[model samples]
Target: MQKEAIYHRPKNNFAYAYDERTLHLRLKTKKDDTLSVTLIYGDPYDWKDNVWQYHKQKMLLTGSDDLFDYWTTSVEPPYRRMRYGFYLEDESESLVYTEKGFFTEQPLDTNDYFSFPFLNEIDVFKAPDWVKDTVWYQIFPERFANGDSSIDPKGVLPWGEYPPARDNFFGGDFQGVIDHLDHLTELGINGIYFTPIFKAKSNHKYDTIDYLEIDPQFGDKETFKQLIKACHERGIKVMLDAVFNHSGYYFEPFQDLLKNGEDSKYKDWFHVRSFPIETKPLPSYDTFAFEASMPKLNTENPEVKEYLLQVGKYWVEEFDIDGWRLDVANEIDHQFWRDFRRTVKQIKPELYILGEIWHDSMPWLQGDQFDAVMNYPMTSALLDHFAHETISVETMADRLTSLLHSYPDNVNEVAFNLLGSHDTPRMLTLANDRKDLVKLMYMLQFSFPGTPCIYYGDEIGMKGGADPGCRECMIWDKTEQDTELFDFLEELISLRKSHSAFGNSGSFHFVSAKDGVIQYKKETTTETLLFLINSSEVIQSVEDLSLSNETTSLFGNKIKPNTALTLEPFGYEIISL
Candidate 1:
């Protein structure tokens, strides 16, 4: 470590983990000087018999603007006491290491066997470790409600113009939700996932014009405080959509660089190229992965990193929010998250950070970064199984097997299992108002490994499809509400909440996959519950069912399966013992 070189995490002492097969290794210097970094994995304590020397591996290293990024083989060779280091390839060529009665004239190998010891503790946020069995709900605020109208915006932004249709304010602020906390409380959800309340342009505030400011459309700072207080009072924690991957076209940081061009004080704030666009359809820097509006920021830039990190810390310090739902998380630089995680935990150790990773998210969940992901996988499963009827029992079995194995055992605990969201249609329409299948999915949602997040309208049997359609207003009129569906959902939640073990203590095991009928059991040390579902159109005669004698069905219906438990079409049950 040099006195002049600057690094994002300059204190030097670091701790890292490789959660899946993907390995992203990075080292920061005090300054942006010409330097080089190498990664080696094996027994850092012993290079015994040359067997400890790991070689013949594929590696990648690239430098963009200033920061250097690279990856290496992620093979864990059952070795203990593994050490790695960074060596600056400057003219001076200094080697960095923990001092313990040792000296190096030149850059020393990170895994160079040493006798003396150097010790310091570093805590890496392990994901899926504690969240695999919990369920989460995702909510879009504007559509959710205008909890408080006193704070609604009276005017629009100076540069805002969207065909007069895209008004930023929609009366759905945090305080509005405070007016109706019981809407979610009745569902027995442990947390609420709100999209970016941070200042933005569009209705679905993905483009973070200002990370620090809460969108006026959603009320001001104080309103958020009340919302936080209200939710916390009711045992429901809150996590907001963290849109750090990109910024709105009008974001001050980006706008400044655009106006000042190369002479801008923050010239290196983005991935500048030789050709602003090389043509039209793609502007200079006004795109994400080269689109048109969602411009990607250079997270590798020091200034940019500092700004975003501060914003994340602001929420924790200002509102005591429980977690963050990072948007477009996969597209951003991995090192940035590593830094973000460290900075956030400094404010609150229990801050849960879930990424918007639609893929397997195995790598992200491997005890290193995110606590969970918006379970698009679970959503797709529910859609395919209940709607399209394409997912068969065996196919489901195979998918679940691979899903559990994809990440470590903890993933299912944290995955937010939503039947539908504002991004997609409500389950009512998706299920075509079948009531039966919807109830079945609700049972599965709560019964499954992850936390079940009920979209505000979805619980009351709201219906719609796709973006604008899915993002409909909440039906405040519970008078005409689908009481049957609502009651069934309550049963599922009550069953999980009443039994301490089922909350997260139980392990899921499939009992039988007969035709379209799927049966599974959730059991912890002190409790046992059985789930019986028939996804088929025909009634099922499930014989020798794998359930216990002591049964209390959810929806307050207690029944037994003596003469081959008969499932009326899409019948599903959450029976407890």
Candidate 2:
């Protein structure tokens, strides 16, 4: 066979794309390798509208051209922050940098951009404040309940085995989820954040074995359709977790590499060095360098970038999922995030994309990618005050004050406020099933600045911890059994629905905090609501809580703050005007 020059690391497909700093330019030239590769950067900030023409320079290879090493000509200085591509000298063919190999740049007219500073505000990643008070519920499918027992594993999974593996499958699924929609709606949850439903080997589905299909165990595509319709009917929105960080060990692309080694067509899809077995921990192999079961992807690969982008758009076009909750967001490269966010906005301008960040997310909240994230820090603060009581009234005030002042004003609107999720101990369980204390926690959750979210069963009181424990199913049996806690959650939820000024785009100010009594006010142009919670063990009273004129008394606000309105230990009050 005639010697062939190709970009396909799979060694079959000749297609090539440039990405990150390394340009994969291959050509079976009648000319020699002495030919120089020219790169130019004219558009300072423009990737779409402005212009760029290649300026020539000999492609140098004194050292390895790894993913992060970029190249350009002397005529055009490379812009550290920009949108540009590469061109091969012999072919005049240009390739754009992507998660996979490059694709030909389309006509400039094809690219479109809307007015700058999108959404209700300029912060691209920040969601509106209403997100926090609205209350979100995260559900892990398998282990929740086997709605269709027939689909359950033949007792072959870890949930049935001793020393269950975190990655084992137990068959909790969509139909089981369908059966619980009523429970979710009645509990007053406004958002449903589901773990990955896409086809994958592990029960958690973080490793996407197949991005295109739903896990058969989770039910077919239409079943989710019904679930979506039902959720929307009840005023609930659904968001699914997206694990773009990596895939399972047995994923098809990796399998291809195993079968063909360097000759595989998908060889470029992952990051592998020149040597086969020796490069096992290739740049893409050790994401956390913690495990070998999951292999990270070379998101800088142009084809890989396009492939994942297609997967994201496919779900939105096919199932109409309200948004995406990115799993292990920080693990991915910054270059990948920039492209990913660009593609997402091009597809749907308003789609909600929340990152799964634990510590703090203000950095990503800047104009570009995610809308919000799991409020792990906030959850910790709430639990500290109510669970161990290690937090004092003053300590609690300081924390709340920091949250209000630390983040940009707009971030409060879009944050995913959580007390508990499948990742953490259930809130009710954290409070040790103390209904009074639980009520106190939620009072702050709802009236505070950000969007609020309830764990699946926390509304009616669910309990568990990391992995199998945090993944417990909602208990319907309790519906008939415990009316006190159930009634309390129901009332709190109803209160959230009735108040708009307290929702998104509202403003929050700490009104007072003294003697284990904390109070705040949420206000808009037309409406205002006041909140008070006594996390103390003793009945506590406040001195003077200022109120707006002509305020009507409701649920917890019927009593006077100092004497008549003394809140007992773990008691909470929601006062609106």
Error of 2 at 120 (Å): 13
The count of backbone overlaps in candidate 1 is 29
Give the candidate number with the greatest lDDT: 1
lDDT of 2 by residue, 1-577 (tens): 1113222121111111112222222222222422333332223354343553323334432111111111222222244222223344333444432223344562232122111111122322334333555567778777655677666654445343343356556677788888877777767777888888887777777778888888888888888899888888887778888888877777898788767887888887765645353334444344435455566777888888889888888887777777888888987776777677777767766667888888756567665767776677777777898886887766666566555434544555677777877667777677777877777777777666667776666665666656667765455576434667667767766766677765664567666667778777777788776677776778776545554343445573454333445677766666665
What number of backbone clashes does candidate 2 have, counting pairs of residues 3 or more apart or in separate chains?
38
What lDDT is obtained when candidate 1 is compared to the true structure? 0.65
| Backbone collisions counted per model | 29, 38
Model 1 Cα lDDT, one tens digit per residue, 161-190: 222133444556677677877867776666
Residue 175 displacement (Å), model 1: 1.9
The ten-residue window of minimal lDDT in model 1 covers 6-15
